[model samples]
Target: MVNPRSSSSYRLRRSRFVVPPTIYRLALILLAFSVFLFLVSQRQIPVFDRGPSLPQKSSELEERLWDSASGYGYRPCVKPTHKYAGIQKSTGATDHMFSPIENPKSERSSATAKYFLCAFVLMSYTLYCRFSPIFNFLLASSHYICDMVAVARLMNATLIIPQLDKRSFWQDTSTFSDIFDESHFIKALENDVHIVSELPKEMESAPRVRKHFTSWSSASYYEGMSQMWKDYEVIHVPKSDSRLANNDLPVDIQRLRCRAMYYALRFSNPIESLGKKLVERLKSHGPYIALHLRYEKDMLAFTGCTYGLTDIEAGELKILRENTNHWKMKGINSTEQRLGGFCPLTPKEVGVFLHSMGYPSSTWIYIAAGDIYGGETYLSDLRSQFPNLVSKVHTESLATVEELKEFAKHATQTAAIDYIVSIESDVFIPSYTGNMARAVEGHRRFLGHRKTINPDRKGLVKLFDMLEKGELKEDTKFSSLVIDMHKHRQGAPRKRYGSLPGSKGRDRFRTEESFYENPFPECICPTDHH
Candidate 1:
C-alpha cells in the first residue's frame, strides 16, 4: 500500500532467500542416502546384493555339500555328516541326507533380535534347575535343560548355568560342567542367549522371583513371565521340564530349540571321546544293532511288571516299589500293566521278536542297557539266539578298560556312551519307549533319519502270548506278520503328530508328540525348498 515498486523489490528479495522445491527434494534425498550409508556401515541393515556367487561346477558343488555336512568352521555341535552310508544304502535312506534349510546368517540376526531389547534396559537374569526330581534321568534332564535355554531366550534374559540334581534317584554328584562341555554350550548359544557361568557379583543378592512355570506352557505364557523383569532382576525357575509347549510356537523359537538340543548340549570331552572310541570299535566290526533292553530291576519295579520273574523276584520288586517314596502308584496291577503294553519286553521276547524279524544268529548285537533284572539268567535265552550279543562291559578296548572302569558306577556317563553307540548303530531298537529311547530316536532322525525300529509292544504281546500257549509258531508266516506290522514304525521323515483328537486345554499338550522326538517343518526342510 505504501509503494508498488518497493513492495515488488521486497518480494523479489524474499524469493531469493527461500529454497526451491527441487532443492528441498534433492537435499532430502542426500540426507536419506547418508543415513542409509551409515546404517549399512554399522550393519544395522543387511545388504541383499549377491556378493560372491556359489560355485557352479559339479565337483565344487560336491565340495560345498561335504563342507556343510561336516560342519567345517562351524560349532562342534553342528550336525555331523551321516557316517552310516553303508547302513543308509542297505535301508534305502539316501533321500534324507539334505542339510538344514535355515540360513545361518539370518538365524544369527533373528536370535540377536530376541535379546537386543534387554540390552537397552536393566539386564535381567534367569537361573533354573536343569534336573527336576520327577524327570531326573540323563536324557530327560538334557531335554529340560534345552527347554530352559529356550525359556531364557524367550524372556530376553541372561541364563546362569543350570544346577544339576545330585539328590535324584541316580544320587550322582555330577555337576553341569562335569557332564556337559560348558564352554562349548556357552559359545554355541552366544548368539541366541546370554549364558554366564554364574550370577554376576552385583546380582548375587538381587531381588529374584522364584517361578515354577506351568508345564507345557505356550509362548504367550513366557511373554507374560518376562513382565517379571520390571520387579525382579532375576527369575529363578525351580523346575524346567515341559515348560515349553510342544507345538504352536514361532519358527525361530522352534528352530532355537533344535539349535539348543542338537548343537549346544555337547557331552564333556572325556565322555564324548570314550563314546566315539566305543563307536569306532563297534564300527570296525560288521554292522551292529543297538538293543535298548529296558529290563532293569528298577524299571521292572517301577512299572510293576514282574512277568516272567520268580516268586521271590516278584516279591523283591514289589517291596522296592513300595519303599520308593517318589514312585506314587504302589498298587499297580501287573496283568493290567502288561495288557496295556506298559511293560518293557522281556529278554526272551526280544530274542523271539528279532529272530522273527529275520535277523540271523550271526548278526552283531549291542545291548544298550544297565544291569539286567536277573543278569545272565534272564539273558541266557536271548544270548543263545544271538551268539554275537555284547555290551560295553564286554566290548571295551584294551586302552579304554581303565577309562570304562572310571565310568562304571556313574550311570549317567555309561548311558551317554550307550546313547552315542545307539545313534551310530546300523539299527536302533528300544524295548520300551522311555526317555532315552525317545531322545535317541529323535537324534537319529536329526542325523538323516537313520534306521530306528519302534517295536509295537501292544501288537507283539498278543503274538508272544499265543506262542507261549502253543497257539502260534515262529514260521515264515510269523516273520511276515512281524515285518508287516512294523512297516510304518521305522524312523521316517514326517511332521510331528499333534495332540490326540478331542484333547483340550493342558491335556492336549500332554497328548501331543514331543518336539524332541520330531523337529520337522521347522528345523528340517525338504531339499526342494531353501
Candidate 2:
C-alpha cells in the first residue's frame, strides 16, 4: 500500500478502453450512413446495370417525344418478326377475331365500341335510284354505300335501305342480303347512326324532299341540308358517289366511314366461310401470289389494249370503245397507250416481270379477276411461266355448278370471293391502278402495308420499249432495272394528306380523298390496336 494512488493510476492505464453498447451501435450506423451517402452522391447506382434511373415523369415525357419524332404516335413501327404480322381483320363482332388489334375481352361488355348520340331526322324517300349511282366494281359500290351511310349520318336523317344494282353483269336479283349479312351490317353500325330495314310507318307518310345532294359536298353542304330537314321532312340524296366531302367531313364521320366499310360490311356467312376455305387451300401449297390481272374483256376494250390480240379482236375492242357513249375518250391510241403504260399489262409481260423479280416458276399465282379477255388462249403465256395460276373461278369449278348455282347467281358474290382471297394472299400484284387495285392497296396499307408490288408500269414500259429495240438484254441488266424501278412502289409505309394541299373555301371539298383508296398513315398504325 506504499503507493496506492500510483498503483490505481497504473491499473486504469493498463485496462482496455471499451466503448458503450449504445455508442458502438451508433458508430456502425454512422459508417453505413456514410456508405449510403456516397452511393447517393454518385451519378449512377448500379441496380442490375440498367443504366441511370429515370424519374418516372421525365422518362414518360422523353418516350412520348421520341415517338412523336417517328411518323406515327407513341407506338413504334411493328417489328416485322412479331406474331400476326400483316394480318388485318374487321373490327366487327362476326369478324373481330380476325382483327389485327389484340382485343382479348371479346366476352366483356366493355370490349365493344360505344357511341352517345341522339337520333336525327328521318327522310322517307332518300331517292336511292333517282340519281343513278354508277354501276362500279364490288369494292367501288361498297365504298359508295359507306359514303351513303356517312352522308346519312351527316344529314341527321334516317337512311332507307339502299338497293343493290340488279343491272350488273351477273344480274342476281338478290337484294343487299344476297351479298352482305344484313343483320351484321345493322348491328355493326348501330352506334354510329340509325339504319332501318324500312322507313317507319309514322315516318313513311312524312313529307319527303326530293333533294339532290351535290357531289363532294362538305360539312356546310350537309349543314344546309339539315336546315332543309325542318322545311322538308326528308332530303333525297340522288347520287351516292362523292356525296360526302373526303377531307371536309368531321373526324367522327371519317372514322364512321371506315367502321362502316371495314367492319359493318361483312360478307354473308356462306361466302365468308368459302373465302376462308379457299385461302387455306391456296396457302396449303405454301405462300401464293394474288395478281389482279386487269385483263378482263371490258378492261381491254376500255383501255384499247390490242397488245396480244388478233386484228379481229383489236377491231372489236375499238368498236366497243367507240360505241360506249359513257367512255369520255373515244379516240384512244392503243400503241401510245401501251407505250405510255396506260394500258393494262398483258399476260406475257406479267410473266416476264415476275420472273425478273425473282419469283420462281414454282410460285403459286392466283389470278383475281372476272375473266381474261381472250380466256385461256391469252393466259397461256402466264401459265407457261408460273403454271400454278389459281383463281376463285378455278376453285369454284371444284364444286359442281349445281352446288354453286346460287353462289354463282351474283357477280357481287363471286367478287366477294376474289376479294377475300386477294386480301389474304402473301403477295398481291396489280397490273393497273383501277378502283379495285387502289382499293386493295389502300386496304393493305390499312392492314399493314403487305407486299403489293404495284409494278412500275410506266417505267417498265420504257425499259420494254428499249428491249424491243435491242437496246437492253434479258440478263442482269433487265433484272436490275426492274428491281431498282419498283423500289418505292413496293407497298412501303408512307404519309398521305387528302389530295394535294391548296384547296381554298368550298373547293376544298373537291380535294376530298377516298377513305379506302388512300388511308395512308392516318387511319393506319404500326401496332395492331387503333
Candidate 3:
C-alpha cells in the first residue's frame, strides 16, 4: 500500500497551487469593464469616414459647407459634381466666399441641423473649450485683436469678447464695447465661430488654464494646446499679440483673419459716427495725405532714441525709460539705434523728405499722431515745409471739436478716429513702421491697392546724414533718389515675403512679413478670378 504521509503531502501541495473562486470572479469583472471602456472610447473618437451625402438646398449647402471648413472637424460639404451640373451658375460663390465682404449666414434650419449632427457625431470625442484672451498690449493695434480672434477659431473654442488691458502704458480705461461694436462683432462672426459677450454663469468661477502661448506659433501648436481642455473648461491667454504664425497657416484661417479684421471689427457707434464725420470734413477740403508721425515722448523713451533732442530733453527721456517698469532694454546706444534705422525720422528730416517727394507746400497733410515730443519746437520745421498741415484739433466744426474734446483723454477712441481718417486719405505715409502703419498699409491693399508710401527709413537716414554733412544737395538728384528708392515700396500687389535665408524654428516666423501687414494671395485674389 502507498505510504499515508506521502499522499497527505501531495494533497497539501495541490491545495497550495489552487486559485480561489473570488479571484476568478474579480478577473472576469475587470475584463468586462475593460471591454466596455474600449467600446465607449471608440464611439467617442473622431473618425474620418464619409458620412451620408448632405442635402442639396443651395443656401443650406453654402452654410453647412462654410461651417464644415470653419474648424468644425468635418469633411467639406461637396456640391453636386454631375458632368453638366453648372456649378458656375452660382455667380462667384466659390470665388468670393473668401472675400472679406462676403457674409455667409449660418442657418438653423432642419437641414443644417442634420449636417451639424453628422459632424458632431464624427467629432464627438473632440472637446471644445471657451477661450478668453486678455489683450494686454495696445488696443489701437487692430491686428492683435484679429490675431486673437483667429486663435480662438484655431483652438475650436467659443470666444468670450476679449478684455482690454486698462493698465497698459496708455492708462486709458476703455472696455471692449467702448471701442468696438460688440454686438456687430458677435453677430458678424456667428457663421465662423461662436462668440459670447461673457462666460456662462456656471463657468464664471470654474478653474481656468492661464496660457501664454508661444510667439509666432503655428496652427499645430494650438491643436496641441487644446489637450488642456480635458482638465479645464476655459483657457485664458494673457497676451494676444503675434500668437499666430505669419505664414503657413491654412487658407481658411488666413481668410477668417481677413474677415474678422476687415468686416467684423467695426468701431463703436459713437467712435464710428465721429470718425466718419471727420473723414467727410477732411475729404471736403481735397486729397490729403495721412502722415503717421510716431514722435511722442513714450515712443522716444521706449525706443531710447534721443536723436535730434536737446541735452535736457534726452535726459528726461532717459529718466522716463529708467522709471518705466515694463521697458526692459535700458541703456540703448542712441547713435547705434539711429544708424540701424530704428529711430523715427526727426520732423526736419520728414519735411525734407516730403519736399523731395514732389509734394508742394499747398498739399493737405493730415498729421495722425499723438503730441509731438517737443511740441511746436520740433513741429515748426515740418509745418514750415507743408503749410497745409492739419490735425483733428484743427477741425473747423464746433460740434466736432466738442465731440473730440469729450474723447480727449481716451487715446484709443482718438486713435480710432485717426485710423478712419488715415485709411480714407488719398495717400498714406508713415515715418515709423509701427502697428498702425502696418495695419493701414494692409488695409489699403485690401481696398484695391491704394497709394501708401512706406518711407525707406534706412535709406532715407543715410541720405539725411549725407545732407547734414553737406555731401548731398536737395536738388532733383536728391528727389530722384528718394522717388526711385520707394518706387516698389508703395502699396502694390506682390507675394508676401518669407523668412530670411538662415532663419530656423520660431525665428523663421518672426522674420517673415506679418500677415496683417500683407495678406496678398490668401485674402486678395487675382482679377481673373472675379
Candidate 4:
C-alpha cells in the first residue's frame, strides 16, 4: 500500500548496510595474512613445505642412520641366518654387535681422544638408596648413565666415573665394575667427552653445581645449565632424576647415548654368560614368546592394579601405593585404572588376548618377572592356556631352574638374562609398557622390526566390558574386534608419531614419547642394508 517512490528509497538505504565486495575481499585477505604470519612464527610452514628430510648427522652411526635410500626401514622377516648358541659363538663384529663390550683397540682409541677435552665434572647417584625399591640397575646405570654422559658432553665437562648407589634394599656394596664394565664405559665416551677416574688434586676444591629435579627437561633447560660454566669450575649432577632433556639433542650426543648404552655398558662376564645360556635354553623349546608379565608386587603396588587380586592382596597393594613417597597420584581408584586400561593386563586378560590372537595352547611363553604378587594362583589362568610357560623360577628341568637360582640372587643378573632372551625371542609381548618393556621394545626395533604385539589397552577394555556384561560372545566376534583393534600397533615400519594434539610448552615433552623410549625408526636398520 506504500508509495512506490518511498519504498524504492527505503530499499536503497537497506542495501547500503551490506558490506561492499571489495571490503569483503580485503577482510579475508587480512585474515589470511595474519594466519600466514602466525604459521611463520611457529616455524610450521617451512617444515611442511619442505617434505620430511632426515635430521642432520655428526657421527658415523648418524651417517648410517640417515642414509637416504636405506636408513628409514627394513624387511621384518629377514632375520640373521647365523645360528650361534653361546656368547662367543654369536654373530661377531660384522653383524649387529650384541657383545656387551667392544674390544681393547676401540676402547684405547676412545680413551686417547678423551685426554684433550675441558675441565672435570664428577657425577654421583646419591639421592635415595642406590638400589631403592624403585631403582633397577638397568635403568639407574645403563639408561640414565647414557643421558648423563650426553649431558656431560653437552656441558663440555670431563665426566668422572659416576658413583653407583650401594646402600639400598639389596645391601650389597656393588660398585660400578660389579655391575657394568667400568673401564669400557670410560673408554667408550673418550671421543665424545673426556672421562676421568678421580678428581685431580688441585681441581678437587672446585665449586660443584647439583642440578634441580626437572623431569623430562627441555634443551633450553640444559643450555642454561651449560651457561653455568662461567661461574662454576665443575658441574656435579648429584641425582639421576631429571638429568637429561628428552629431544633436540645433537646427532653426536644422541649417537653417544646409543654407544654408551648398547656397546659400552657391558654386563659382567658371568652375567653375560648366564644370560646367553638362558637364551639358548629358551630357544631349546624352538621359538618362544618372551612375556614381560608386569604383575609383580612392586609393579602392581606402584600402578595400583588389583583386578585379579584377592581382597587381602588388594588391601596390601593399596597400602603400599599410599606409603610410597616419590610415587605421585596416590588416591587412584583401582576400578577406574582397570576400566580406563591404565592398569597392566591381568594374567587372565593376557591369556584371553593371546588365545584370541590364535596362538596355539602349546606356545611357549617365558615369563620375565621377579616374584609375582599372588604367585602360582594368579598365573594359573595364563598357564591353563599356555602350559609351556617357563621362567627362571619354573622350568621343565627343575635342576636347570635350581642352577639359575644361584645367579638369581642378584636381581640385575636375572633381569639381564631375561632381557637377552626377550630381545632374541621370536616374539615379545609386555602386559604393561613399563621401563623394562620399553627398553626391550626399542632394542627389538634396533635388531630389526621384530614382531612386538602391543595391546590396544584402552580399546580392549571396552570390548572386555561388553563380554563381561554378556553383550558380546567370547568366540569369533571378540577375536575379530581385538585383531582389528591392534592392526597398527604390531611393530610395523612407520615414522615416529609426533607429540599428541594440544600438547604445548613443557607438556609436549612431559609424557615421554614412545619413540624416545624405542629409537627404532631413528637409530635401527638391517645389517649392512643401509
Candidate 5:
C-alpha cells in the first residue's frame, strides 16, 4: 500500500460527500408525516358524530371492550369479565372510595393528560384512513384498563378486599395497618380473582375474601386466622356488600374452621411434619424449661464465638467435669448427645437437660436447635456420668427434620414461646430468644390467657440489667413478670432448686446463679423452677 497513513487520508477525504438540500427536505417531510399518522391512529378521542356521551355500542374505541366483556361470549381476554365480576355485587363503596378524584391531585392530573394525549394521537392517525395494526393494539389496551377499573367501581366482583383502603376507606388505625399487611387484597387481584371492595369503614380492619365467584368455584379463605376473638368486633354488613353472605359464591367451611383453630399454624409450616409429630406426642402438664443452645456454625464461622462458650469449651476437660456434676440420668428416652460441654448441645442432650432440670421432660420443651441429634453421644455420656438425680428426666424430641423448610420456623422460636403460655398453668424458663418471650406475652394478650412465667431469671436479670444500663426499659411490655425473683417461693420447692446444676455456661460466659426449687419435681408445676 502506497503509504498506510496516506491511504487512510484518501478514504476519509472521499467519504465527505453531503446529501443535497432538496433530498434532505423531502426526508424531513416523510418523517413528520409518519409521526403524524402514528399519533392520529393510536388512541384518538373519537370525533363522534353524536354528542359527548358514553361511546356507543360499536365503532367507538371504548365500545370494543364493553362489547367483548359485557355478555356471555366475552371470555377471550379474561380481563373485562374479571372486572365486571368483581364489581357485580358492590354497593358502590369501592367506586366512591377509590374514585379517580381521590388520587393525589398531581397523579390524577397527569393521568388525565396522558389519557387525553393518547386519545388525541389515536384520533390524529385514524381520522385519515386504515391504520390496522396500531388501531387494534390501542383498542385491546383500552378494553383492559377500562374493564378492570369498571370492576373495582361496580363492586360486582366475586372477591372482596377486607383490608386495603380503597379511596373510600375512612379510618386509620394501628389495627388497620395490621389488616393491610396481613390481608391478601393484592394477591387476589394479581391472580385475576374478582373481589368487591365494600368494607368502607376504617374500623372494618379484618378482611375476608371471596374467590372466583363467577365460576362458582370454591370460596377463598382468609390467609392467617378465623378465630372468634374474645375481644373482636364482628361486623355483619348487608348481604349485598358482604362476601360472607354472598349466596352465589362458593363457601369454604374448612377455611372457616381453620381460622378458629386454637394455635396459629404459621409456626407449623417448615416445622409442619415436626409440628404434627409434636402434636401427636405432646403431653400437656405443668410448666417446663426450654433451653436452646445455638451451636455448630457458631463454633466455626462466628468470627470469635459470638454467643460465647460454656465452661465445657473454655476450661475444656475441667468444665466437662463440671457438666458431669449436673448430669441428671434420664429414665425417659432422651435424644441427648452433648457436643462439647461449653459448645452447642445435641437435641437429645437438650431433651436430657430438660428432663434432668425438673420432673417430666416429655412435656413440651420446644427447642429451636440447629442440630437436634447432632451431638447425642456427648450429651448421653454426660447424662450417663451422673445417673442418680437425672435418671427420672424425660425428653421427647420436639423438632427434627431431614431437610429444613423454614430456617426461622425450624428454629422453633415462636412455638417455644407460646408453649409456656398455652399451658396457662405452667411457665417456661428458656435460655434463648426474647422474641419468643415477647411472642408468649403477645399470645397471652390475644388469648386473654395469662400465666406466671419465670424464665431463666439469672440470665434474664443480666440482660435486663444490660437493657437498663443501655437506658432501655427492663420490661418493654412484660416488665411486670420481673420482680425481685428471690422474693416469693411460697408453693415452690426449696430443695430441688438448690441441688440442680447451674447452666453449662462456665467461665466462658458469666451468669447470675440462683438455684430455684421444684414444687412438683416428680411431675411439673408453674411453681417449680429447677
Candidate 6:
C-alpha cells in the first residue's frame, strides 16, 4: 500500500551508501597489495648514507659560560654528565630522577635493562605517531633526550653536579636538578668530621670564608663524590626495604636528608631590612657585648659541658673539703666574678657575673640565643644584678637560628675563628664551635692578618667525644649554663685578651674584648664536674 515513488527513493539511497563502503574496502586492500609489490621492486633508496655526520663543536659562548661558573679552570666543580644518560634516557634532568650509581658493573645491569624496557613500552605505543610534530614536542618535554645528553656530558669525569654557591646553584631549575642529583647531595657533611685529618699548608694558611670553601684537592673531592655511584659495587650505607611504602631510606640517609630540608627551609634576611632593627638595639659610642646563647634540645644534651659551678669548685672539688670529713657549703666565688667584670659573658650565670662585674654599670649587653625561656629567670636575675652591662638580655634578645642564617646571607660569612681573631679584643672566645680544622684555616686567613687569637678549640675534644656516643645534644645551652654559673659563683673571667668594639662595624657583636676564660688557680676548668 506504499507509494511507488517513495519506495523507489529508499532503494536508491540504500544502493548509494552500500556501493561507497564496498568500493572503499576494495581500494584499501588493493593499496596494501600495491605497497608490498613496490617494496619488493625497490629494496633501497639511494641517498647520502655513506657515513655518520660530523660532530658539532661547542660554541665559544658556551665555553665561556661554563668557564666563568667554574672559576676559570678546566676542572669544573661539576661532574661529567654522560654516565647517567643511559638510565635517564633524556638530554636533561628529569623529575625526582636519581643517578643509578647505587650499583656498579653487572650489579646495575638489571636497572639499566629496566630503563630501556620502559622506553620500549613507550616507543611501541607511539610507533605510528613517532614522526608527528606533536609527538616530537612531547618527547622533548618529557626529558628523555635532555637526560641522555646530560649523562653523555658527564662522561669526561665521574662528577655530574655543580659546586656549592649561594647564587649560581639556585638560579635556574634545570641546572639545579642536574647539579643536585649528582651524588648524595649532603654526603660531604659528616658527624666524624674526620675527612680532612691532615689539612694541606695552603688550607692551614687560608682565612675566613676562603677557608670554608678551600681547595682540598678541590679537584679530587668533587670528582670522587661524582663517580661514587658509578664505581661502587653496591650501596655504602644501606638501602630502603619494602617495609616502608612511602620512605625506603635508612636512618643515616634520613639524617643526611635533614640537611637539605634545613637548607631549603632556611630563611635569608636582607641586610638593611632586619639588620636595622638589630642595630637599633645597640647603643652608640659605648662598649656593647654580644652573648650568644643556644638552648635548643641539641645544645642541652652535651656531656662535655657542665652542671654549673665556680672556678674554685672547678679547680678543687675534693680538696675543698678542707680535710674535714664533712667539708660543705662554701659559696662559690664564681669564675665570672673572678674576672672583675672586664669581659662579656654568656648564658644565665655568665650574664649575671658580667652584671656583677659592671655593678656600677659600664657596658651594654646583647643576648643572642634560642629557646629564650630556658634562661629567662636567670637573665632576669642578671638584669637586677647589673642593670647596666646586663641592660638587654631577654627572650627578645635571642636571635633565632633562622635569623643567624639570614644574617649569614648579608654578612659575607667568614670562619667564626677568623671573626673572633680579627677583633682587636682583650680576648676572643667561642663556646661550642669554631677552630676545628676547617674553621681554624678560615680564622687564620681572616683574623691572622689581624693577629686575633682564634680559640675554636674550646670544646672540640669534648664535642667530638659526645658526638661519637650519639650524644651531641644540648651543646650550646648546656655550655652556657655551665659557663654562666662558673662566672657567677667562682668569679672566673671570660678571657684575659679580646678585641675592641667598632673593629668590624658598630652593629657587629663580636670582638676580642668580649672574650673570657675561667681564671682559676688551675689552668683549665676540670673536664668532669656535675
Error of model 6, residue 21, in angstroms: 99
Which candidate has the top score in lDDT? 1
| TM-score, per-candidate, Cα-based | 0.77, 0.73, 0.74, 0.72, 0.27, 0.27
Per-candidate Cα RMSD to the true structure, in Å, reads 28.6, 22.2, 31.2, 18.3, 35.6, 38.0
Please write out the lDDT profile of model 1 over residues 1-530, one tens digit for every residue: 59999999999999889988999999999999999897676564221121112224545522321222321112212331232111011123211111122325577645544443333243445554556534327888888888887777667566789887677777777778878899999999766666788877877788887788899887778867867867787877776467788889867677778888888999999889987887777778767789999999888999999989999999999999999997899998998899889999999999988877656576678888888889999999899888878888855441357777778567787787888889888889999988889999888777777778899998999898988899877765676688788878877677899999998987888888898887775766654443
Winner of 3 and 4 under TM-score = 3
By summed lDDT, which 10 consecutive residues of candidate 4 come out lowest? 94-103
Candidate 3 lDDT over 1-530, as tens digits, reads 99999999999999899879999899999999999998887676432122112223545533321111222121111111121111011143211111111223445434433443343333321222222222212333467667777666655556777766666557777777888899999888766666777776766666677777888888888868757755776777665457788888777678778888888899999988987887777678766789989898888898899988899999999999999887789999998998898998888888888777666566678888888898889999989878778887754641356677778777777788788888888789898887788888888777766778888888998999999899988876777788678777777678789999999976788788878778887887654443
Using TM-score, give the best candidate's number: 1
lDDT of the structure predicted as candidate 2: 0.66
Error of 2 at 385 (Å): 0.1
- Evaluated against the true structure, the overall lDDT of model 4 is 0.63
Q: Residue pairs in steric clash, candidate 3?
A: none
Question: Model 5, which residues run further than 4 Å from truth?
Answer: 1-277, 284-366, 372-374, 377-425, 448-530
lDDT of 5 by residue, 72-106 (tens): 21111111211121211123332211112123458
Per-residue error for 283 in candidate 3, Å, reads: 1.8
lDDT of 4 by residue, 1-530 (tens): 78999999989998889878999999999999999897676563222111122232234322221122332356332121232111121133211101212224477645533421212222221111122324445554567667766666544455677666556566545566656777887776555555666565666666666655476654456646655655666655656554555555544445566777777778777667766777777677766788988888878888788886789998998898888787897887888988888888888888888876656576678888877668888899889878888787676441275566556456666676778778778778899877788778766666566777899787888887887899987665677677677766756556555577888987776564653356643355455554
Question: How much is 297 displaced in model 5, in angstroms?
Answer: 4.4
The TM-score that candidate 3 achieves is 0.74
TM-score of 6: 0.27
lDDT winner between candidates 2 and 4: 2
After the best TM-score superposition of candidate 5, give how far the Cα of residue 86 lies from its true spot, in angstroms.
19
